[model samples]
Target: MDTVTHALIGLVLYKSIQTENLSRESKRALLFTAVAGSEIPDIDVVSQLWDRGGEYLMWHRGITHSVFLVPLWALLLAALSWLFWRIFDKRIFWLGMLAVFVHITADIFNPWGTGYWEPFSEMRVAIGTVPIIDLVVWALILAGFLLARFGKKPAHLVFRAVACLIVLQFASQTVQGLAIKESAMSRYDQVVLAADFQPGTYKVIGKKGGQVDIVRTSLWAEPVLLHQLTSAEEADLQPLFEQNPEARTLAKWAPMVVVEDTPQRLAIYDPRFFDRGGSFLFESMEK
Candidate 1:
């Protein structure tokens, strides 16, 4: 997800933690705890940039942003915090978990997606909807901010409501994303896909004319994922299959491809597919 969304999420989460439902000290702890955890996942980006330069941000998002990595890192962070702040050990653990949960949940909605089953697979699993920095979500942040900044007693109502709405939005995206994936699958004999609700992403890779067709939609700003396939310029995949079993697999993806260069085929499976740091073509509604 985008940084704005991340920061807003932190604000909303911090306000919620400060609610009367929790003790004042606990609330304070939650605020810092959540912020710490939330920003931690992104900590990898610094290293990635340092190591691989800005070019690595794309792939770097996968590792530190992985669900599997979040818990482990948060737990590690919590352990260290517990040891360092022995006086606030209990407070740290409880609020720390909440903080960690917020951090991860926020990322779940992020369209960049995460390696939920990382170390096991490299697939980026999306929570299934919304851009990480959608306008409507930002509005929610404003609402929470206003309530927190000026509302008198018991602003908990607004905070809780905003949090719930955000969570529900992410949940709804997950459902819608699955439906979209199923839709793509139905369109082709086979489809490999992923979805993200926070930044609202839906990407699918399927076969078209024996080539790979990659389609992705941005649920937040745009509504549909468009695709085209182009591969196998002079080769008949079926005839060459026996010589190269691996070729057989790629042969099935010859006709549908964003780009077909030697040893690399671009099977665009996310709305970001069209985003190359410049304005992109948007097929709002297609034939």
Candidate 2:
């Protein structure tokens, strides 16, 4: 998810807490815990500033976003809250854990996944059932914000309702995406699904050997063929990797890539990001 969405999720969490009897200082402390915990995992993004080996892609959502680090982050946020406000409520610790957990879980569902179980596993858990900036989620949270600003109901109740709706939306989208994948299982040796920005729409990528088919479809509609790609699985990519550092990093990061080999150059790009002309992750080396 984007940074703004992550921050908004923290704000929603802060509003959902029952702080009716808490002192002003305690409430402020909880808010700090919620927002800080939600954003702390992304601090690994700073690695790009000092990265000279083209490893920024692997380091950004690496160990810092690990499930093992969640408790450590919560503990740090709780300690900071105590130091800043002198309010030592246990809710501060628990709220920090919840905020950090939500951030990790949300990113797992996005196409740009995080290292959910790092150290134990190196797999990128990208379900691709949710877009990074989901309009439905945005609308639900924005509606909750408006209701809290103007409605007669308590802000906590409104945000709680919004949270439930967001969960329902996520569940519905996941089920549909899984169903689409199941429908294509027999046709392709490997399949990947990417959810469109609009609800109920998806791009189903099916790969068999060197052939790949990208189809745009929905739950109730016929699949529309978008682009058919071919990968040179037998091509020698070592020279490309030797000359292009980004190609080396991309080959390690992407689940699969489409290769283009010609007399002038050897180029490769991730099929997942291919649209219109080409993908930004595309790299080539001249002969």
Tell me the number of clashing residue pairs for each predicted model: 25, 0
Candidate that scores best on TM-score: 2
All models: lDDT? 0.54, 0.88
- How well is each residue in 145-228 modelled by candidate 1, as lDDT tens digits? 787679874566677789898777767666777666676766776565445333456666666554655566644445454655
Q: Candidate 2: how large is its RMSD?
A: 1.3
Looking at candidate 1, what is the lDDT of residue 283? 13
TM-score of each: 0.64, 0.96
**lDDT (Cα, 0-100) at 226 in candidate 1:** 64
Highest lDDT model number: 2
Native-referenced Cα lDDT, model 1:
0.54
TM-score of 2: 0.96
